[model samples]
Structures are given as C-alpha cells and as structure tokens.
Target chain A: MQQTRSIEMGTGLFVLLGMAALFFLTTQTTGSNSLSGSDTFEVTARFDNVGSLKNRAPVRMSGVTIGRVTSVRFDPDTLVAEVKLEIESQYDRIPEDSDAGILTSGLLGSQYIGLQAGGSDLSLQEGSEIEFTQSAIVIENLISKYLFKQDSGSDEK
Target chain B: MLRELYFSFVDFLRTFGALQLFFLRLLANSPAILVRRFGLVVQQVYNAGALSLVIIMICGFFVGGVLGLQGYANLAKFNAEDSVGTFAAFSLLKELGPVITALLFSGRAGTALASEIGLMKATEQLSAMEMMAVDPLRRILVPRFLGGVISMPLLTAIFSVIGLFGAHLVAVDLLGVDPGAFWQQMRSSLEIGDVWEGIIKSMVFGVVASLLAVWEGYNAIPTAEGVGRATTRTVVITAIAVLILDFMITAIAI
Candidate 1:
C-alpha cells in the first residue's frame, strides 16, 4: 500500500512537470499572434518583385517588428505582386504616405518588409495602400547589371 | 539450401503474424485496464517516466549545448551569429527533441519492460497467472503499453524545454549574442506548425516503442537465454523503427 502511494505521488509529479513544459512551449516560443485577434488592422502594398518574401514574414519599422506579411499574391492586371500586411493595433500611427520595401536580414538571411514612415499627419487605416514601395533586390540582376556596366565602361575607354 | 531459405521465410511470416495478433489483443484489452486497473497504469507511468527523467534532462542539455557551439561557429562565418538561437530552437523542436527522446526511451524503459516481462515468463509467473485463469494480457501488458504511450510525449516536451534552456546558456551567456534578438527572432519565426510536428512524432514514437517492448517480452521462449536475447532485440529494433518513422513523418509533415 505504501509503495503504491509513493508511486502515485511520483507519477502525479511527473505528469505535472510534463504539462508545465508543454505550457511553456505553447505560450513562450512560437508566434502567438493568432489571426482571430481583433487587435490588428490589414493594409496592402504592391511590388514589381517580392523575391523570397514569404507569408508571415515580419514587417519592421526601424528594425522593430510591427506586423507580419499575411499574404503575397500576383496581380495579373497590375503585373506586380500584391502583399497584404496585418499590423498590430498599437502601431496604428503609421503615416499614410509611408514606403514599404522588401529587405533581407544580414547578407544572406530571410527577407522581410521594412516600413519607412512618411512625414504626414494622416495615419494608415485598414484597407489603405502604401503608395511608395521598393521590390526585393535580386542578386542575379545586380551581378548582371554590374558586369554589363563594366563592359560598357571598357568599350568607352 | 532452397529448403532452408523457404523455411526461414515461413518463420519470418509466422513471427510477423504473431506480432500483429499480439498488438490487436493489447488494443482489445486496453479499455478494461483503463477503467478497472487504472492504478496499475499509473504505477507503470511512474516506473517509466519519473525514473527516466534525470537522464533525459542531462542528455537534452548536452545536445543543446553542442548545437549552440556548432551553430555559433558556422553562423559566425556568415556574420549571422545572432541567428544561432533561431537555428538551435528549430533543430531541437523539430528533429532532435522527439527523435532523441524516443531513442533514449527505447534504451532506458524499453529494455527494463522487456527484461522484466521476459524474466516473469522464464520463472513461470505468467503461466501461474494463466493457471489461475487471470488473463495476463489484460492484467499485465496493456497497462505498461498505455503508460509508455502516455509518458513519451510528456517526456519529449520536457526534453525540448530543458534543451532550449541549455542553448540559451551557451548562445546568450557565453557567446555574447544579444539576448533580446536571440529570443525575439525565434519567437517571430517559429510557427505553431513546427511544434505540432514534434508533438505528433513523439506520440507516434511512444506507441511504437511501447508496443515493441511488450511484444518482445510476452513472446520470449521462457528461458534465461531467451529473456536476454529479447531485451537486446527490444533496443535494436526500437532504435531502427524510431529512425525510419522519424524520416517518414518528417517527409509527410514538411
């Protein structure tokens, strides 16, 4: 009887420890910005090329994430990529004329949207589109352009 | 030679058939054990889970530390040392946590369960119960199997948590990476899907490891040598099964 009682106590503690670990993982580690949260507003931007920008990529202002790219889709009519962003409600003061640029982290890291706020009193609201946008810099394009410019310069010389 | 080969193939099929029948019997008997002999299951859980916690925690810490050291070295070449946290967290949560925990569990608890039941068979304790008309399958095997399945995912979860802590100790404390970026990048980049993949893998591994251990023991030849062989086979087969299953699950989940 005593042995069984101790076993029960040990089992209960082990189970509790496992539960606590799981709770920490779910609450602490992953992106908990559930889509169902009403504390965010969505906006759109268009780019000539999105490069490697993926859905859920961070939207940063001055290196601090304010939202995430919710979707990236091609617009056949515009011949561009339309990006949907969901910004936290707390960061609703972003100016209406801000610029959205797809930028990479470090030299070879994943790409995210970098937002440069404009000098305007009007704030961006739900469904508003940012007017000025920069597409991701394709490395191949840069290399080819550099080579072509050098060839032209050499020919002139 | 052909006759011998044919006999071996038939033996393999017979063993496979028996294993399938054994699993079905265990599943059939599980409900009764859950309701009536629940305390037995709890006792097995204590035996399998609490007893193995210390070793699992220690191994998790070391594996995480190694990952941090290696990740820092490789990422620093690219001037991306700051992303080591994200790297370590992904590897640990997605692959190492469930796979390594299952491997260790197979070695630790699987061997114990196999040998214990095999020795019982060797000593005729199982036969004694059979003579008394108590179904040993219901009275013995189902509780242990259930306990293992219940304990495995919990153990994997604890292992991952401790592992992340170990990585923090190395990456942030020793390596001088910014603490805020270390956690922030990991939080923002890690989706719920990666965590779910680990959970699902651990749950599946738990069932496979437990079932293999019990089946090996139950069918031992009721001798000392046979019991020893069963224990060895339990560890060997469980390790191979866990790796193959890990690859299959990762391919599907990814």
Candidate 2:
C-alpha cells in the first residue's frame, strides 16, 4: 500500500513535470512572448542590393529588435531593392536623417537592418523613406573580388 | 476461387463483429469502472507511467540530438545554420515526437498489458472473477486501459521537450549555431495550433493502441501458447494502427 502510494505520487509528479516541459517548449520554440498587439508604422528604405535579405527579417537598433521587414521589392527607376520596414510605434524617436544598414549578427548569421540615429531634429514618420541605406554584404562577392585581385597581382609579379 | 473469396469475406466480417462487441462492452463498462475502481486505476497508472519514463526520456534526448546535428549540417550548406532550432521543433512537434512515442509505448507497455492479462485468463483468474459475480472487463481491463490511454499523451509531450533540449545541446554547444537565433527562429515559426495537433494525435494513438492491447489480451485462448501469441499481436497490431492513424490525422490536419 505504501509502495502504491509512492508510485502514485511519482506518477503525478511525472505528469506535472511533463506538462511544465511541454509548456516551456511551446512558448520558447514558438517565440511569441508578445502580449501587446503588433502595432507598428510602416517605413521604407532603398539599397543598391538587399543580398538575399528574406522578408520578415528583423530590424534592429543597437542589437535590440525594433521592427521587421514587411516586404522587399525592386524599384526599376532607381535600379535598387526597396524594403518596407514596420517599426514599433514606441520607437518614434528615430531621426529623419538616420541611416539604415543591412547588417548581420555574426559571420554567416541571418541578415537584418541596423538603424543608426542621426543628429536631425525631425523624426521619421509613417511611410517615411530613409535615403541613407546600405545593402547586405555578400561574402561570395568579396571572396571572388579578392581571388581575382590576387591572380592579377601574381601575373604582374 | 469464388468459394474461397466468400469464406475469406465471412472470416473478415466475423473478426470485425468480435472487435466491435469487445469495444462496445469496454465502453459500456468504462464509466462504472472509473467510479468503482478508482484506486486500482491509479495503481495501474503508476505501473504504466512511472515505469515508462526512463525509456521515453532517453529516446527523446538522443533523437533530438540527432535531429539537431543533421539539421545543422543541411542548413549550414545554405549558411542558414541558425534555423536549426526551427527545423528540429517542426520535425519533432508536428510528427516524429508523437508517432515515435506511441510506437515505443506499444512495444513496451502494450506487450506487457497483453501478457499480464492473457496469463491471468490462461490461469482462470479472470474466469474465477466471473464465477464470483464480477465482470472481468470492469475489474481488470478498465484500469489498465485507462492507464495506457492517459500515459500516451503525457509521454509524447515529455518526449518532445527532452528532444528539443537534446537538440539544443548539439546545435548550440557542439555545432556552433547561435543559441538566440536558434530559439528565436523556432518560437517565431511555431504556433499553438501545431502543438495542439500533436497533442490530439498522440491522445488518439494512445487510446487506439491501448484498446487493441486490452482487447487482444481479454480474448486470448486459455493457453500459454495463446498468451504468447496475444502479446506479439498486441505490439504488431498497435504499431500498424498507430502509423495508419498518424497518416489519416496528418492528411486532415494539413
């Protein structure tokens, strides 16, 4: 009887632990910790290239995410990729003349737009375009450029 | 040839009727059994759940690690190694975790349920209960049935969590994927609906497998040879049923 009781208690504890673990997995893996609405203002930035920047990529300021890329498109007139960013409403202090650079976290990690605050008195508004933008750095392009330069120098030598 | 076809059809129908009769009786006895034999049911749960934990957790952790390692290798080819967590989570939560856990449960517990009950029948213990004016289905089958049915989903959920942790160890600690990126991508990619689907599938598999095990045991011939055959049949039939149900559930889910 005591053995049965102990096993019964163990079973209950086991189940509770399983439930807790499952809840942890569901929340952690799904990453939807936000309770507040996804309320944000949309803005645009143009770059010479987006370099495989997927839609729904993060927009960050000083490594903290402030927005997300809603869409990516090509403007034929400018011959550049235009990306629409949806910035959180709370981050309304970004200056109008601020720069948005397509940056990566670490080498080979996902590409994101890193925003730098500028010294302008005017802040960006909904649908505002940040003219100063940088494109994603393509490692293949850099590697090929270095290889070509090295070959040419060797031929001269 | 026509005679043989007719005989085979008859045999199939006979088996089907027997199965339906067993299921109906089990259902009829279920509510009464739960109320009257609550402690027995609890003891059955302890036997099944507590005993099964070690195997389930071990499988979850190793399977998760393998998934993480393999996912990293494939994602690394595209330099998208950070997405390993999302891949592992989807693979485990949506399909592998529940299905594998059910299969394992059938192999471990289903065989045991069959043999335990079958041996009792062979030894006339169940018949003796019938002589004493007790329904063996209420006395014996119900508690074990409830034990297996209840254990299934909890085991599957545990398997998934442990597997994810194992993947984390391999992906973040060993293969050098960014821990934040791995988790962030996984969280953003998954939703409540996916987890719910997994839970529902595992629960269904659990009930079906448990029923098959108990029914096979209850109907076994009163002999040692019959008991052995029922145990084997319990595992084989439960496994096939689980796979078929999984496919049907996936089709409807997607």
Candidate 3:
C-alpha cells in the first residue's frame, strides 16, 4: 500500500513536471509574439523584393520587436511585394512617415522588418501602407555584381 | 500455390478485421471503463509511466548529447556553429522523441504488460473473474490499456526535455558554441505546430502499442508456451506498429 501510494505520487509529479516543461518551451519560443491577450493593429508596407520574408517574422523598432509580419503578397501591377505587419497595441505611437526595412539578424540569419521612426507628430494608422520600404539585400546579387564588374574591368584593361 | 497465397491473404485480413473490432469495442465502452477505474488507472500510470522515467531520461540525455555533437561538427564546416541548438531541438521535437520513446516502451512496458495479462489468462484468473459476474474487460484490461496509453506522451515529453538539456550541455558548455545564438535560434525556429506533431505521433503510437499488447494477451492460448509466445508477439508487433504509425503520421502531418 505504501509503495502504491508513492508510485501514485510519483506519477502526479511526472504529469506536473511535463506540463511545466511544455509551458517553459512555449513561452520561450513565442516570447512576446504569442498574440494572446494583447490586441494588435495591422499596417502594410510595399517593397521591391521581400525575399524570403515569411509569415510570423518579427517586426522590430529600435531593436525591440513591436509586431510580426502577417502576410506577404505580390502586387502584379506594381511588381513589388506587399508585406502586412500586425503591431502590438502598445506600440501605437509609431510615426506615420517611418520607413520599414527588411534586415538580417547577423550576416546570414533569418530576415525581419525593422522600423525606422521618422519625424512626424501624427501616428501611423491601421490599414494604411508605409510607402517608403527597402527590400531584402541579396548577398548573392551583390557578390555576382562585384564579380561581373571585376571581369569587365579586366577585359577593358 | 496461388490458392494458398490467396487464402493466407484472406486469413491476414480476417485477423486484422477482428482486431479492429476489438479496438473499437474498448474505445466505445468509455463510460463503463471510466467509473471506479480512476484509481486503478492511476496505479497503472505509476507502474507504466513513473517506472519508465529513468530509462527515458537517460536515453534522452545521451541522444541529445549525440545530436549536439554531430550537429556541431556538421554546422561548423559551414561556419554556422550557432545553429546547433536549432538542429538538435528540431530533431528531437520533430522525430527522435516520439519514435525512440515508443520503441523503448514497446520493449520494456509493452513486454511487461503482455506477460502480466498473458500469465493471468494462463492461470484462469480472467475466467474466474468472469465467473464471479465481474467484467474482466472493464476491470482488468481498461486500466492497463489506459495506463500504457497515458504513459507514452509523458515519457516522450520527458525524453525531449532531457534531450534538450543534454544538447545544451554539450553544445554550449563543452563545445564552446555561443550560448545566445544556440538558444536564440532554437527559440525562433521551434513553433507550436512542430511540437503538436510530435505529441500526436506519440499518442497514436501509445494507442497502437497498448491495444496490440492487450489484444494479444487476451487471445493467447491457455498454456506456458502460448503465454510466452504472446508476450514476445506483443513486443515485436508493437515495435512494427509504432514504426508504421510514425511513418503514416509523419506523411500526413508533413
């Protein structure tokens, strides 16, 4: 009977501990991006090339994540990508004229949108598009361009 | 020869069809299975899950450490050593945790469950209980079945948790991989959907393993050799079932 009681107690601990581990993992992974309890507002940005920008990518302002990229769609007429961002309710003070730029974490890390605050008294409105946007800087393109320039210059010489 | 092959195929299908009905019967009678069974179920949980903790943890830790080491070696070649955490975590959470835990379970708990019930049948305990107006299916089988099924996912989760720590210990402490990058990449890459897939796989494997073990034991011939064969079949069949189920779930989920 004593052994059975202990076993039952151990099983309870096993379940509780598993729940704790799961809680820790989910919180750690989602961080502030959980979208639970926090209201979010949407804003769109247009870019020449969004390049590998995925849904749920973080949107940062001054190194702090204020939102996440919700969708990426190609604009057939403009020949650009329309990236929609969902900003947290707390970050409603972002200026109307601020620019959004796609940036890598390190040299080769995954891309995120970084918001550069502009000088304006009016705050950005939901559903309005941020006109000024910079696309992903493709390292391959830069490297190939440099190599092509080097080859042509040598040929001329 | 062709007629013999056709008969054998039909025999296999018949056995499979009966097993399917047995599984459905167990699941369909959930209400009767639940009443007065919680305590027994809990005891089964202790027997099956709590007892299995040590093996799961030890295996999880070593598997994690190996993943960390191998991932580091491979990622270092591309000057991308920081991504080791992401690699190890993803590997464990997505595949290793469920499949390996289920396989180990089929060996340890699966064999134990089969033998216990098979021996009971061999001794006419189930028949005696049936003669006493007690339903052995509800009283005996349900609790043990529930125990095995409930224990599996918890065991898998424990394996994953220990494995992550093992990976961290190897990648960050011993190998000198940047702790921030290791954790950061892991935090960023692992999503709810990926974890959900692992859990679902373990649950399905649990159902497959437990049901097969119980069914084999219940149907075993009433003799020492027959009980032994049933016990052996439990492990072998559970292992195959787990692997096949894992493949199906992965294909559908992916």
Best by TM-score: 3
RMSD of 2: 6.4
Q: Compared with the true structure, what per-residue lDDT tens digits does model 2 show for residues B1-254?
A: 99999999999899879988887887788788788788887777777776789999999999999999999999899888888999999999989998999989988888899899999999999989999998888889988998888888888999999999999999999988999988887876687678888989988988888899998898889798999999999988888888999999999999
Alpha-carbon runs more than 4 Å astray in model 2: A36-157
lDDT of 1 by residue, B62-163 (tens): 999988899899999988888888898899988999999999998999999999999999998889999999988888899999999999999999999999
All models, DockQ values?
0.70, 0.46, 0.52
DockQ of predicted model 3: 0.52
- lDDT by residue (B128-171, candidate 3, tens digit) is 99999998888888888888888888888888889999999999
Query: Please, what is the TM-score per model?
Result: 0.90, 0.73, 0.93
lDDT of 2 by residue, A31-143 (tens): 43352367789899999989878877778898888888889999999898989998889888899999999988676566889999999999988989998988788889999
Docking quality level of the chain pair in candidate 3:
medium
Query: How far off is residue B80 in model 3, in Å?
Result: 1.8
Instruction: At residue B129, give the lDDT of candidate 2.
Output: 98
Query: Clash totals for all models, in order?
Result: 0, 4, 0
Arranged by TM-score with the best first, the candidates are 3, 1, 2
lDDT of each: 0.91, 0.87, 0.87
True contacts kept of 3: 0.41
In terms of lDDT, the poorest run of 10 residues in model 2 chain B is: B41-50
Model 1 misplaced stretches (Cα beyond 4 Å)? A32-38, A119-123, A154-157, B1-7
